[model samples]
Target chain A: MNALWILAVNEYLDGLRNRWVAAAIMLLGGTALALLLVGSAPTGTVGAGALEISVVSLTSLSVYLVPLIALLLSFDALVGEFERGTMLLLLTYPVARWQVVLGKFFGHMMILLTAVAVGYGAAALFTVLVSDSGTAGWQAYLTMMSSSLLLGAAFIALGYLISVLVRERSTAAGAAVVLWLIVVVLYDLALLGVLLADHAQQIGPGLFSALMLASPTDTYRILNLTAFDSVGQAAGIAGVAARSGFAVSLLLGLMTLWVVVPLATTMALFQRREL
Target chain B: MVNAAAVEKVIDVAGAVKRYGDKTVVRDVDLSVRAGEHMVLIGHNGAGKTTLMKLMLGLTRPSAGRVRVLGADPATAGAGRRRALGYLPESVAFHSAMKGREVLAFYARLKGIAPAECRSIFEQVGLDRAADRPVRTYSKGMRQRLGLAQAMLGKPQLLFLDEPTSGLDPSLRRHFYGLIDTLSRSGTTSLTSSHSLNEVEARADRIAIMKMGAIVACGTQAELSRQAGLPIVVRLGVRSGSGARVAESLAAMGKIHRRDEHRIDLFCLGASKMVVLRQIAALGEVVEDVDVMPPRLDDIYSHYMENVQPQ
Candidate 1:
């Protein structure tokens, strides 16, 4: 267990010290500050709502940026060590190979989680100051923000799985970027296209919900919508008052699946990679 | 100090063979280093020395045959068995992010070396002062020294050092081997694989030489030289203008070659070197030195590899 902690601490230090974390913080903080400044320009509830939308923006950013950060942090986890020849150094120790993998995985996750916590905290504080959404709004925003970080943890583990499953870092990086695009952007766009094409017909959003639940990004989207008082589903589910509760249930189930599945895949793939 | 304890088999290999698909890299090697004897294994490049080292460490498994270290097969030696062994692999690399002290402390923890005793292991390997500095800043020799530091933990009864002194400056090489000698004296048996010909001659209690994956030679340097019929050695030094004269005159006694300026070398053949020693005394001051002994490992190696290889 101490060995596992050592690996985790080492990996956590590596990510925290990484230049990417600095860049992510700079990028995420700049955007949040811009949103706050734009909303404070003397407007009413609609304008206030526009600023509150940063909560939604946080989800979107969490979806896209979290996976990108994850891939950056982990896609070269093993191969980088191997390429640099440090793997030979570690192998001489008595620790099992799995400990090394698990340690690095959790270590990187901790780094991303810290970033998400800081970014979401800033976004939430900005939401509170710029909007008149009150205590209920603040609770909703906090829940969504914390869960977004959990969602990031899941994606980072997924990047770790890709890293171990692939041998070449460039190949892993390319594949992970494509995977992030498919999960965060293209999948939603494709779902939107499917939803539009099905508008004249009647197939229920079952397939869409199931497919969206398959991507952690979509899972975060569902969680934010359900947790923050149906903000995301206002257009799609508000008029259908009777079905709103079911959407909430779908959100919880999807988030649960997102957290469980990727973590399981990462752990299992890590078990098999040599060094 | 390492406690030898009772006699035990530290490394035991049985019919180990490794194949790289169609090419067999190591073929049926059966060898062992017992608990208190210095064993040296020497072979040329591409002679399976590196592969053999890997197999012993469980970094690679043999396609056939068994390897047991400290009564446990390394391929399956739960972490406990590994904790008991210290190995210095050739071309050892270190984590750049870890300072030398951090790396040593980490390995010491893994090896179950008591924390109180860990600092001394670093001291023993002469890395105590630089332990806190990151390994990336270390040179090749420093890294090799760090490798030795890590392997010196636990003071295990057995050690496998693959060219442990390869990068050490000659003074440190002698110092390092002196440490090895002290370890063996205090009861740590070791097998050092090296290409530096004189190292085995100077230190190994028994030497094993490999040719094409087979143990072609094993024993002390003197025994092997005697078996190969290497002649007795004689070195003579002249002041000036007499080396060539001494060389020609010494040719009457046996095979003579000018080893260097002011030095005449003769191979004693069919007679004691005392006969040539008497004549060379008349020829010059014999100012340098003359010693009559069996051929050195350098002479025996060339005679064996160059002239005695084929039937």
Candidate 2:
């Protein structure tokens, strides 16, 4: 356990020295502020509070950005160390293979958490000062920020799984990009196409919920946008959100599983790897 | 301080075989290194030197047979048990963004040692001047020094260094062996792998030459040289006027490899080297100076590597 903590701190410091933390903060913070400023124009016409509207807008933004950032941060974690030859020396020490896996997870999650909190926190603070938003607005905004982190964690775990499965960093990078496109971009479009073409009304609410839960990004979107009445109505998903029938706790549970299953699989595979 | 009778086998491998699929990387091999012994594994590339080292380090388990280090199964040894072992891999690397001190401290921490002890290790490997510099700015030699420093941390009882001197300058290579000698004197057992036979000739307590995933020969330099039965060359610088006379008089002694006005090279078996030398001494003033050359580690290594047929 102590070794795990040391490795975690080492990885975190490496991220800082590599300027990954700084870059993630700048990218997330810059985009969040941009979406907050230009996107708040619709609040007056829609008759929704500023924080609630921002939550709706940011949910759309995070579904694209969070997974992209998370995957980029973690795809090279294992394979890069193997290529650089650091992993060989590291394993020579008293550390177990699982510690190496969890150490990287905890460290990269800290990076993502920092970016999400600071970036979305600034936007939340701005919304509070400028608009007469209420407790409900603040509640919805906090949900958005935390769920975005969970969403990021899920993707980071998936990236580590990719890292462990491939032998080369180049292959891991290619796999990560393909995984991102399938989960974040194409899954939703394909779902839309399938639903539209269901002239026989074959796809039911249960099947739709299962389909949405299949992709972590969609699961995160369902959690943040549909869990609240004002946010769901403002994002124009109230009809679908009402019919989806997924409890907030169940969505949170599914998000946690997304993080756990892939990370556990990564640990098991890395244990048997020669390096 | 450890007595000879009380000496332990720090590393023991018996009938160890490692196969990656159908291709066997480490054949049935048996090796043992006593405590305080400096054992060097010399081999060509893909000769399984690194694989053997990995087996002993617990990084890879053998497909069949046993590997024990410090009297424990290396593959399943606990963290506390592994603290006694140190390894420096071939072409060691660290996070390029980390400082030298930071890299050492990271390993020190993993070994449960205080980070403050990193200062003394920096001085040991002569990396103190570059302690604060990021590894990205380090040259290959400096990086190797840093690698040596990390392996020397916690005063480990066993050290496994794979090609530790590959990229080092001659002086740095000497310095590396000097450090190994210092550790050996203090009762640290080291098993190092190198393809450079000349560098380790005088340093290793015993040499194991590996080829095609198996050990062909292993012993002290003198012992292996004797067993190989290679000839000893005796070169003599003759007086200006006696080149012809010296060659004629020594014609029946042994094979005269080369002879000229300035020198004569004669090759004789080890058993007959002194007999041949006495014949030269009989012509006292005709031989101006005599130099006896024993079979070098290079010759012995080549003899074994070339003689062993591939399985």
> What are the chain B TM-scores of all models?
0.79, 0.93
What TM-score should be assigned to candidate 2? 0.94
lDDT tens digits, residues A36-105, model 1? 5664564433322533456655665666766677777777887777666666556656766767777777
Q: Candidate 1, after superposition: displacement of residue A105 in Å? A: 1.8
Best by TM-score: 2
Candidate 2 error regions (>4 Å): A45-48, A134-136, B1-7, B236-253, B261-264, B275-288
lDDT, model 2, position B126: 87
User: In lDDT terms, which candidate is top?
Assistant: 2
Pick out the ten consecutive residues of candidate 2 chain B with the lowest summed lDDT: B1-10
Interface RMSD of 1: 2.8
> For residues B231-285, could you state the per-residue lDDT of candidate 1 as single tens digits?
7877666777767767776677878788777877788752565676678677756
Report the C-alpha lDDT of model 2 over B80-187, residue by residue, as the tens digit: 677888898999988888889888988888898998899988888888999999999999999999999999998889999999999789998888889888888888
